[model samples]
Target: MNLNFITSQISSICSSVWNCIISLDPKVISTIVSIIALAITALTLYANTKNNKKNNFDNLFFHLISLLNKIIISSENNSEKVEITLNDIKKQNKAQLETLKSQKIKEYYEQHKLAVNSRFVELENMYLKIESKKLEKIKKSNNTTDTAVPIRKSEFLSPIDDLDEINTSDRSQVYYSYYQNNTTDEALNYPFDVSDNGIETLLRMTSFKSNPSLAIYNIFNSDGGISQFKANINVLKSEYPQNETIDKINIELSELFLHKNMNIPSEISEDMKKDIVNDILLDNKHGSYFRTVHRILKIILDFSKSEAVLNKYCGILRTQLSERHLIILFYNAQYTDRGKKFKNLVAKMNLWGDNSELDVGANSDAIHFATNNLIWKDKDLKILKEEYVRK
Candidate 1:
């Protein structure tokens, strides 16, 4: 017999023996005892299934705890948060363990930056080439004539140019006049020195050869000529107590009001006019700077017409034709946005009658205005569009 069957038979026999002892009737005891044994076997099978299920649950819980700890550590390392249900934790763990790529990408970025730097050098070289070509043209045109063409100032006007020609004595005259008009109550401290020529000296010292573009760039960007000029005027005012020069400058500024259909106000003082003129004289050559002086003076003369700043300056500067036109051109170079302003300002100035040279751009200012306006014209606007505008 099989061991299991034999064991079952033995249990039945032991039950039969016990029933016979208790009842003293073998037939009745055998039936009741067999039924009880069958019932006990069924109970045993049920208990075994329950214990197997508990063991499986304990193993699963431990596996989930280990996975959750790993996920928490990973999120901390990356400075990010992650949440996962027990079912998905296994898949997420597999994914995170597969690769480490952040360092390789950083190396690639460094290489890309080096490439960009190289390209920048190439672009700079191209600009240098363009400059060299321009120098070659100038050299070719250099001639033996005694009345050779003077170096035409570039379309952009630089104040450094004006400072070159104006000597110490001339600047002193300007400073003396400036001081006399500004200082009324204060005592004069610095007399206009006849020997000091700071403006001229600075200009002589500046060289356009070593780095032509950089030199020009530095001049335009430094001290904003107009603002610096105004500062000097203030310095003069603080030093010189009072003088006739202030009254003269004021009278001249007031006269500018008479030309316009405006009346000079009485409240506008002499000091104010001098200050305004000082500001204008600073840029000396900048159209906007002059324009500012012309307008401010006009406003003081007539408060009601304060909004007429541009109109007044443009109108006045436009009428007085001279080297101012060249100054206007230099200003135009520095401020390309003043194209319409340049045109309007120059148009008002008395133009030469027949000489076409003086007609379109008689001088520097005209050239500055003509170049900007011509390129901005409806038909020829294409070429300069990329240089100045996005659309």
Candidate 2:
């Protein structure tokens, strides 16, 4: 009896629930379904937007890091190229700061700033090392000329020797003392006039007084003398027979009228004249000796007749000499107090513009410019301190 009553009640309840759903408003049910569907769509859109932004930021971040790594690996010899790449990355970083508004990226950059700075320093250090090695090689090459036996004070000498005797000891003392006491302040104050020919100007600018003409004579008068010079000439002629400059040098030197005392031939070709000149100026074995002779010729030769020849010779010599002097100056700048000041000037000038203000674009530009140009003028330093430095 209880089972029958329970079954009838369950049937009546199910029929009542079915009748209620059938009698409900179709519009209201449709509206409820629509709202639920709309909610789900909104949630999906929001999730996709968020993910897209994160992905964009990540792509940019990794790309910048990759550029930096490439610079570290391949930009050893080309600082200018590195500066450009770094600037591009900095621009991207600044853009991220503006658009993505991601604190994670800023944190990432801060953490890696040291690494970036160290890499740049490493590049510059590598360049300095290479340049130093090159200079050492040149000095060693010159030292080969020292094989010439020392001439006695009584040997045939010019008035310049008398002057050398009087100043040699004093000049040496002054040079040594300057090396010991050289300060950054003094270096900064030291006048460097770039208006004159780079060689003469550089020589005059040095703290030590040296006579280029006398230096050349000493090399020319070395052990084997003129005979050894002729042998060096012959070797160079054979080695570079077709070289135009060497031929020209040989022709000019062979002119009997040009070197009446030495009895040089009169019928030499212009090509041989150039070749002879090249032997003296560029031959590795006798180049140092020839360089000295060239310098002496500049002093004694009739400028009117030899002007064209001398000009060509000087152009090559100047280029080579300027490079050597620049390397030396760069080396000195690194080790001297004056150099430190120069470096500080570079550092200050290079800092992100107005460190306190945080202008990413401007700062990026400054870093690029500073790293690219290690040497700065007073005007540049002044502008950097006044315009870019944090008060």
Candidate 3:
């Protein structure tokens, strides 16, 4: 196996074999031939198998790379496709709402009007006949027994009229905000600094602190203190005023923000923004995208024999991904259980690298895979291997 041993044996054998070449020593020549053949075989055995295995491993590595490439490509395409699909869905939703507001309500109002008019006509004709009978009776009885029925005053009110009076401008504005502002271009954000968990935690502060007035101070004391809490509420009230939503989120910040003594009411989901976002995030494409990236990373990570190897493969994968693809990956991993496993793998591998897209503000735009574009700020998906992902 040693190069020196192989070369020395060949050299010594060849030097002796020169005597067989000169003096025509047949036995020495035969022995020399055997020795030469054995040395060559030893050298071949040392080199070929290891090289073959290296080639095979490289082949498999590249194959995984190819699959990763496809996943990234597909994710971008899928995220864009999700955008178109969500727009169509929004338009369909708006159309259905418009139909309910205009067509359905109008049809009901018209049907009620026709039925009421017919009933009124029937009642009038019956009254005329009854009057004739009463007159005959009165004439017959010499007008001795006569009674009068006073008219009841009433007015018809159309359902459409009431709707127009109450919700016309509100409905139009809601439709505009819900459909238009929810688009990928605008970034589909839930209003204010109130996060999904923030809403819940703030609402549940009462359970933590019995005294309502100093509830925020006591509850969020561990988290950056009351100043941070007040700043959060201030941002919430300033950025998203309660009046922006037609159906109004019932968590009155004035009660909690200004009046520190008052209890935090609850999460602000009544406005339907959260529900609308929840609906879009339920797309199957999101799950499928997660699985692909998860599996890709799994294979790479499982195959990796060392930390260096893991970083090498992960770095390669990271280089291959576009910002949109990373956005989709981050979105899936942010929410689901399957994504938890995927996220753990990502953290383990440090796939995003030091200057991750998140670090570089690549997430400033709308995330494509979040059901049209679940708008999150640049900091929303910031995850580092050294630090866990932040909301």
Candidate 4:
């Protein structure tokens, strides 16, 4: 209480004494009244001290609650921003795979890649036209016009072979799956002996007679084959203007096959270099969010001697998280050094408790687990998910 409040209480007590003095028969003698006044003053001072402590306690408590709300809001907003950014990236990746061009797409991807990849239809049609021509040439050269239902064998439909089975909705998923699997765990292993038969001759297939696309591609790529193939492509590119100049790639490949050094490609494109550097970044701006959570935990842990208050607030934190937020948490805790403290704190509190299944995600930390050489027999990253599973 302030000085004025204490003074008013003291004055009210004195006024009662004055009234007693004014009575014809005093309520109490002066000495007794003085002693009673002293006792009342002592009680008033004690009450004020207790009130001050209560006010301070309440101030800290309300401040803690306010901070808790702010942390929760920051987490939600950060998670939403991360989700939006990831969705935009995924859409862009999907669009680029589909060869859907815009200013942004044009800027990110090379024009040659868009041209070569976007027109798989034309490439397949060219394959068919060449196949028909080859059959006609054979018949004319033999001088035989009697062929009953001649089967046009097309085991070489590269573009639509796998794509024919997948629906449009599943195309992106299938394309990416194949795209990601293109890389091997180790370096390139050349088949047979490239030195003995020329690297190009060893790699390319002689049977793909109608088109030399595979032939030229085989020389250059086998996941970026030997340095000689790149040199050969560079030599060929001088005459072709572009290695994959879509208009006459078949012509260039046809020329490539004429030499004993080159044959049909055993692999797909030699240049499977896709850029995704920026997508590796764009993170959750929630470092402050986690720090604040730690402070809240500390406050709760220090609030009482027991674990009751700490568990209560941990429950509060768990309830605040969405599934997306949980995914974010799983990534941070399992992968990042900075998130270790928060992870330990939550684990200690049994934050997920019996609801630990909420923390258990499907391959949520797969990359981290793989990178760390963690075996699946050891539970992988899922072990971390059970950190707070109740006993």
**Index of the highest-TM-score prediction:** 3
Per-model TM-score, in order, reads 0.17, 0.20, 0.35, 0.33
Flag the better candidate by TM-score, 3 or 4. 3
- lDDT per residue (tens digit) for residues 1-391 in model 1: 6999999999999999777678667776787779899999989988997778656644553454344334334433111221122112224333332221223223332444344233323322332343345435645764434432222122211222221233223233333221222122122223343322222222223343333223322333346532432343343344343734433433432332231322212222334323333343342333333354333333333322332533443344333333333333332322344343433433322221112222333344332234432312332222223222111
Candidates ranked by lDDT, best first? 3, 4, 2, 1
Q: What is the Å distance of residue 326 in model 1 from its true position?
A: 77
- Candidate 2, 175-212: lDDT as tens digits: 11111121211122112222211111222333113533
By lDDT, the best candidate is 3
Please give the RMSD to the true structure for each candidate, in Å. 38.5, 33.4, 23.1, 20.5
lDDT of every model, 2 decimals: 0.35, 0.36, 0.45, 0.44
The 10 consecutive residues of candidate 1 with the worst lDDT sum are: 78-87
In the range 104-181, model 3's lDDT, one tens digit per residue, is: 333433544444333323322333343345334434553323232211111111122121122112122221111121
Q: 1 or 4, which is superior by lDDT?
A: 4
Comparing 2 with 3 on TM-score, the higher-scoring candidate is 3
Q: TM-score for model 1?
A: 0.17
lDDT of 3: 0.45
In model 4, pairs of residues that clash are: 204-264, 205-264, 214-265, 221-270
Distance from true position, residue 53, model 1, in Å? Answer: 0.5
